[model samples]
Target: MRVALELVKEGRAEACVSAGNTGALMGLAKLLLKPLEGIERPALVTVLPHQHKGKTVVLDLGANVDCDSTMLVQFAVMGAVLAEEVVGDQKSPGGVAQYRGRRNQRPRQYS
Candidate 1:
């Protein structure tokens, strides 16, 4: 994990993905990559299968225990960017859309 982070720090890699120890990965990533400007915390986001046979992006599963509205907004923006850039049209098929989850309510989609 350290070596993978080092490669990212050295600009040899665009991103790093790991399935091991979420907390450790988050800590190491924060330490090595640093947060993007205006992004106070880096979110741990992943694409998951939705009931509609589509993919949904979820973030900060364990990286953050509690988040404020601002943090949530930041995560949403980051998720949207990831969906557009990383996931791409080939994977999405329906085009990139941002889905914001509300308390006790279904996710609201925005183009």
Candidate 2:
């Protein structure tokens, strides 16, 4: 995991994908790559196809399971930017961003 992250950091690779332990990957990434400035914790985000249409972005799947409001907002902003850039073109309409914390908790959504 460290080598994979190092490749990206050194510009040898664009990104790293892992099918190993989530905790291990996140731990190594945080230690090796470090979080961006002002980011309390780095999040793991995935893009999934929505049931109806378009794509849905889910974050912190295993990293930072208990995030604060500020962290949630940060994840939302990052997810929105990723969805817009990777899932759609600039002309596409922006979609909503939502954050659900813990099981059984109500979801907080934004446009």
Candidate 3:
């Protein structure tokens, strides 16, 4: 992941994508890659597989499961930023980031 991010930093790649454990990946991303200009938490986002490239973005899958309403709003904020990054340019590598937390951590999404 570090190598890939280095490539992006060096302009060898446009973005980084991963499908690893949400908490682990978010932790690693926060450590390796700094947050976007306005992103407080780098967030874990997931893009579901759909026909014709259709999908939904889910952020903060389980990183902060004990989250309050404000935390949920924060997830939406992170998701919006990720969606923009993904939709920014087709040529860009990161299209839409999403989160898939552990089986022991799924929660009801109200948004």
Candidate 4:
């Protein structure tokens, strides 16, 4: 855990993944890197298989035991953002004309 945190601190690693001890990892992360702005506490986040053949984002698996409504909402928003920006397919489907042309084609600008 210390080594992972050190790598992150030294810019050698972008992020750290650990399954050793949730409490210890959270404590070390909080003490070393600090929380992001507007985030009171960090929530555990993971991607899980969904029933609809898709993926679902689950949060606060164990990191936070008691979360208020606000915290839950925040987690929801964070999960959504992560899914959209990191996991979701950004390109349009094959049938969509908007994405059928040149790969570098930009979206049409509205006057």
Candidate 3, after superposition: displacement of residue 43 in Å? 1.9
**lDDT on C-alpha atoms for all candidate structures:** 0.71, 0.72, 0.59, 0.67
Of 3 and 4, the candidate ahead on TM-score is: 4
Q: Look at candidate 2 and give me any clashing residue pairs.
A: none
lDDT of 4 by residue, 1-111 (tens): 979987897889978899689888888877787655666777677777878757766666667755565776676666666677766933312111132223345456669
**What ordering of candidates by lDDT runs from best to worst?**
2, 1, 4, 3
Q: Write the per-residue lDDT of candidate 3 for residues 1-111, one digit (tens) a residue.
A: 767766776789977776666566566667777665545566555766546655556666456645545556666666666666774423312222333345455556777
- TM-score for each candidate, following the candidate numbering: 0.64, 0.67, 0.52, 0.62
Worst 10 residues of 3 by lDDT: 89-98
Over 31-74, each residue of candidate 1 has an lDDT whose tens digit, in order, gives 88866567887877778878976677766665776566788777
Better of 1 and 4 by lDDT: 1
Error of 2 at 19 (Å): 2.7
For every model in order, what is the number of clashing pairs?
A: 0, 0, 6, 0
| Model 2 TM-score on a 0 to 1 scale | 0.67
Which residue pairs in model 1 clash with each other?
A: none
Top candidate (lDDT): 2
Stretches of model 2 off by over 4 angstroms after superposition: 89-111
